[model samples]
Target chain A: MQGDPEVAVLRLGHRPGRDERITTHVGLTARALGADRVILAGDGANRAETVADITERFGGPFAVDTVESWRSILREWEGEIVHLTMYGLEVQNVEAEIREAHRERREPLLVVVGAEKIPFDVYEAADWNVGVTNQPHSEIASLAVFLDRLFEGRELDREFEDAEKVVVPQAVGKRVVEADDE
Target chain B: MQGDPEVAVLRLGHRPGRDERITTHVGLTARALGADRVILAGDGANRAETVADITERFGGPFAVDTVESWRSILREWEGEIVHLTMYGLEVQNVEAEIREAHRERREPLLVVVGAEKIPFDVYEAADWNVGVTNQPHSEIASLAVFLDRLFEGRELDREFEDAEKVVVPQAVGKRVVEADDE
Candidate 1:
């Protein structure tokens, strides 16, 4: 998987717990996305304290690192579909980098997994924007199915393009409404 | 309004960019709560750039400040009832401070806002707890009505003591089934 790459799952967070959630969730997403590789990009780690937890959950050919190191990895991999998931409250620069990476490597679709509203600048940067459209309590699986479709040559049509894209300052409840409406 | 201590409104934030929605929705509530002070907390001024977007729609008297400055103002004000509305997303120490303040100051009630899950530890720290008992997108006014009756001695039988709380992650379009059910 390392000699040539196909997917980079970017989970942006400086915090450890969130990084862990993103790493675990992303690794799970990789198998379904059917990319050549799955990488966890965040500030998380696998320590002795979390080893039991990790083995039980995040099964990985995993490379976990900060966004900078992942950037280095993506450059090395050259052309792969990168799935970007933003964690935590601050996402100003991370989205820019995703858009920039998309511009540089147009081979892969940039599927953004957003926790909250993406900033306005990020939205303008996007080629296509859509909500995950996963039903409530079914996020993990919803994303999994989406990734699977990507592997099967999914174009991310209106179902996805119409997804309620939440940018900054929108209430979480409102996002729930938009997601349901679409 | 701050000088009068009877201004009947308060606007507080855990951080910036987070106060506007809560403040905007809490106006009818203040009247219903018979509140004379609206205390906005946190570094909301520096962190929240969208405050103006929501505040323009606001029609209430509220004081907002960074956490550093709000303390002095809080010490000077006294109320028969104190409704503490705060954002609870990764809080670890809310219980001790809120309880100590309540015990030392004889303030009867503290209303915690912005959490789908009520912090039991924090509630244990205060005299009583209040929360929304409706579906998602329920008006902040409804909650205010409940609190008003709760504080003005009109609805002493109304209770937040045994309220069932729902906890949900902030990811939008993610399954948020449990946040509204009580």
Candidate 2:
């Protein structure tokens, strides 16, 4: 999402077909806002069929990789990470996966959306923890844009210098783009 | 476990120190009865650790290979094949990764666990389907063997066959092990 400024919307969810209603809704909204990728994770109802359906709708260049736990993800971490950890699409081994991700140490634009408030560990890991992606969808949708705003904003790291960087180590080597409300 | 002359006792749930227990118990029970391998699964704490500690009891004679999922088990499928499709493990991507396994229609030894008991379906593609693993410590130990015996010799399949099999196809492949009372 950082590579371009035009992406207006993004919706993360579990599976594709079963979650197609939400994906379609997100796709329409993203097109309205001019967003980038419609990211997905977790096993939705009718997973194989659903993913196949969603893959057809993404009309641009993107990478789809099969990851075994988030540990491998951190080892392969690059710049500006984003986690759909608890994006309303529950899956097996999530707590274990997130624990692995925390061990990996990557700092990107983290925006997680779930039904209820996320557990404490995720919020500490996320740059912006926006609870309930579906209920008050419109309001949280605006929060995604706020991330774009901060990315475009100057001296984004000024907040980091103010607070102790206890979250992650400098060895991770990535600049964090955080928002005001976050 | 009751009908058959041999038995395989599985110590479910997590505890890094299970090997000592497995060694002591397996020798005390299964060894005395002259049973086969006392199969042990879980990350010691319900897939919590990198490997099940029980795999390393003896040095040369008892080397254990702990596979994260059944897909990791490379078996030449011949005879009455058993394909256990539990509703809660992390192996949900099997339709794609091991698509070939499902391609050729053949009977197999399928051991389906979890699903019916778990509160959700998003994680059903997993091998263990052990959502209860996350419950309180007292809640985690498996209840299958005793439940089988309690029911009196009729395996779960005779009763739950068409019901569960309809939701997950893998159940259709096995001659589900029965209990004793039936």
Candidate 3:
């Protein structure tokens, strides 16, 4: 899990019962796509538990936590802030510059993904306002593509440690085995 | 609005109220990430309506429909079938071959994305079972990354015909104007 710049995802605006699954997906996507941790900034405690459970079951150095105030994290963050939004600059256009600021500069990266209708200040707070595509789609998808671009697809080869279950990739079948078997 | 191969996404096994937003994301992701259409196979009529509404407002050649049988669509599809699954072959390893089949060989591509548990028959049905990353994340994320890789990122520049609202990419603010304004 040694990447140049430590990456964290902040999941903003979790509407308790309604966004549980989407919030969980955001956290899991953060873990799977090479982010070191995710801070769930609202009432996403249960979603944190779900992500934590997945990490425990499927090996992780990844962390998930619930925070009361997202603004404090943004205000105190030491490195770059990237907000993924449909209204932001296209990812392809800005990815290389952001990647250099992140990796070459060795600055820790905090990626912010919001639920519907993000506050205006979040955009102002961001060092890079990025869009995977200007067309409306899932925030999970945006985050996934953004991370893939940020890491330049090397994140896909990442192997997690201390996993109970590990997926053995198949061509035409499903296979999940003990990590020892891997 | 022309690409090498016509791509359609099939969302499999959606539960009514629980999967409403996720299914909507699946359809929207398909549309935004350069797919021609999305076919929701289960109880996703309302999700189709939402996607259609977005298309009407944002402009699209994208189509969304609710289908009675996912199996029939798979059987009836005359092109290459790729199922996005965590248990499938890694996308990075197989994308070139699949791309050649779809683009160079002139085969239409059917990308299948499933909810929680897809049946074994689906594994058998797909010509290529592709995984964006062999880790549990959102199917919407998997579909997005898969399409991004399939099209090699050209889809980000796509323009929709006759759109009322188009996002004007910004550095730190939101601005969506009429497509005519462009």
Q: TM-scores across all candidates? A: 0.28, 0.24, 0.98
Give per-residue lDDT, candidate 2, residue B139. 17
Residue B167, candidate 2: alpha-carbon lDDT: 18
lDDT of 1 at A167: 16
Ranking by TM-score: 3, 1, 2
- Evaluation by TM-score, superior candidate among 2 and 3: 3
Query: Candidates 2 and 3: which is better by lDDT?
Result: 3
Give per-residue CA lDDT, model 2, range A1-182, as digits (tens). 32433222223334433343333333322221223333333432222333333333322232233222333333343433333321322111222343234334432332333222334444344333321111111222333233322332221121211221112211112222222223
Q: What share of the true interface contacts does candidate 3 keep?
A: 0.85
Q: How well does candidate 2 score on lDDT at residue A18?
A: 35
Candidate 3 per-residue C-alpha lDDT over B1-182 given as tens digits, one digit per residue, 9 for 90 to 100: 37567899999988877787888899999989899899988687668888998999998899987888888999998999999999999999999999899888999999999988899999999999988888898998898888889889988888898789999899989899987787
Clashes of each: 20, 34, 0
**lDDT of model 3, residue B84:** 94
Summarize candidate 3's per-residue lDDT along A1-182 as a digit string, tens digits. Answer: 36567899999988877787888889999999899999998787668888998899898889997899899999999999999999999999999999999888988999999988899999999999998888888899999999989998999999888889999899999889998886
Alpha carbon deviation, residue B131, candidate 3 (Å): 1.3
> What does the lDDT read for residue A116 in candidate 1?
35
